[model samples]
Target: MAKAICILTGNHTAFGVVFFKSDANGCVTVKGEFTGLTPGKHGLHIHSFGDLTNGWISAGPHYNPNNEMHGAPQDEKRHAGDLGNVDVNEDGLAKLEMEIQHFHLTGIHSVIGRTLMIHQNEDDLGRAGNEESLATGNAGVGVAWGVIGICQSNISEKALEEKSNQ
Candidate 1:
């Protein structure tokens, strides 16, 4: 299985770490944990670039190579970066787990070189009847962001080669 990781950072005290793993079936599982967040829904996505030379905004927009409109994770027309929302608890801690089909850890559509974006507000999923909604799900300003990188797994190189041949 292919794997990746993102360690979130920003101008605030909030922090987050996310993991991505791919199964043999081509589905990618996203798992993450966060702290110091406002109690509510927050939009989570994968931005286009991993550049952080000028901070989070330098990461660019959502990873929409296909030029699709912003929408929910289940929306067939949503951008590749649209992973929907993650709910934060009153204690300011959030745990996330989801399966996605639009992106992967390897291959041409790999997200390993992209960036993860956490928005300040809940994603309207393009149903807000506004242009911003259709473009960004109206996710508001990015509160935190991180670059996705290839993770060195504990699995031995021999095992990885064997799995790839199967």
Candidate 2:
């Protein structure tokens, strides 16, 4: 079965679909939609943990499956959840797409058990200088946040049985 998680942030929103090929193999694709942003760029990433109690606090640090410090998504020493920034037009809207590796839909490392966040500021790729810049400078507050979860499949068992009989 294919699964996905949808998240809505303050500045932008995203939908991620995860297809499992095996226990240890899978693909994650995400598309983001946003409007009414502050203009320029903003930091986007997946938090390590999920907060069922408080949506704001539930989002922990970046998803560092490798236990390394924070870095850009393309950086070799970066966290698994370090996706970098998203640019917003003058109208304050932006769209983005991404494909991720070393993440899963099920099991312990499953991204479905975490939170997605959109920050109000840009990420300097952890090189902004000073403690504030540590791990993208904490980038600004989370303007919007959402928990990840598997979407329900449209095809039901009954529907499949009928199609097979046909």
Candidate 3:
């Protein structure tokens, strides 16, 4: 019913595109691809703020409106914004596709106007024994980030007419 898109960019010329859409089944579907990162796993999460003035730092901590500890996307105790990680291939390209019920467009946990971050290292899934694991998931510095925004639907009259004719 609604859609959102982000143009991700960050350290070492890292960049990617992501789309957040409200699926027909009342769930959110995330689909996108990223590149210009190291060949390995990297953290991915939705941040608190949408402002990118100071890059990733300005986005604030992971969106934890529910006051939950950091954990894997599949973990029942993880933050609402915890999206786990994106695995880059040998050429530093990552294609991401997932459906998560952690957030919604109409709720206190809504991700609208927030930002998504891509960390420099793999997220340990908050299973590690480190002190910050419960906070940052042991994910290293943010290498790339993007602001999430509601998508605008603009249809051309010509396209509408063509569709009607079909």
Candidate 4:
């Protein structure tokens, strides 16, 4: 399975981390934990570009290579990056885990080398019936963001080959 990680920061402060791995069936399992955010629900998504030097604005739109509409991860016609929302605790911490079968860490729909942003508001899953909602989910403000990158492995060469040979 392919694996990746994203370390997010907001307003120049340490924010959180997200770990991702692929299942044998090419689906993706995402596990994320965050701190130092407003206490409430926030939208999270993977953007088209990995560049975050400008607070992710340079990242462009969500990763929608398929030209789909904005919707939930399980929606039949949603951007590949639509991850719904994450709820933060009163103490400013949040944790979320989800399995998505529509996209992967590699290939044309790959989320690798993209930007993950945490918005200031919850995503309504494109049910708002507004133009902006269909484009941005009306998820106010981007408080934090990160770049998705490949995670290195610690396995030895011989062990790797032995497993492949099996």
Q: Per model, how many backbone clashes are there?
A: 0, 3, 0, 0
TM-score of each: 0.91, 0.75, 0.89, 0.88
Off by over 4 Å in 1: 155-166
Give me candidate 3's TM-score against the actual structure. 0.89
Could you tell me the lDDT of residue 143 within candidate 4?
Answer: 83
Model 1 agreement with the true structure over 1-166: per-residue lDDT tens digits: 9888787878576788888889999999888888888999999989999998887789888999789999999989989999999899999899999999999899988999899988899999989998999988888888888899887777643454344336
Of 2 and 3, the candidate ahead on lDDT is 3
User: Any idea what lDDT model 1 has?
Assistant: 0.87
Cα lDDT tens digits for candidate 2, 84-127: 88888887778777766656677777787687777878887788
Off by over 4 Å in 3: 153-166
lDDT of each: 0.87, 0.66, 0.84, 0.83
Q: Poorest 10 consecutive residues of model 1 by lDDT?
A: 156-165
Q: How much is the lDDT of residue 136 in candidate 2?
A: 50
Clashing pairs in 1: none
RMSD of 2: 6.8
Over the stretch 1-166, how does candidate 3's per-residue lDDT look in tens digits?
A: 6677777887858988787777666699888788899999999999999998998899999999879889999888879889998999999899999998888765577788999999999999888987799899888888988888776546432343344336
Pick by TM-score: which candidate is best? 1
Model 2, stretches more than 4 Å misplaced?
9-25, 154-166
Candidate 1 vs candidate 4: which has greater TM-score? 1
lDDT of 4 by residue, 55-152 (tens): 76888898888888899877889998999999999999998889998779888788888999998889888889998899889887788898888865
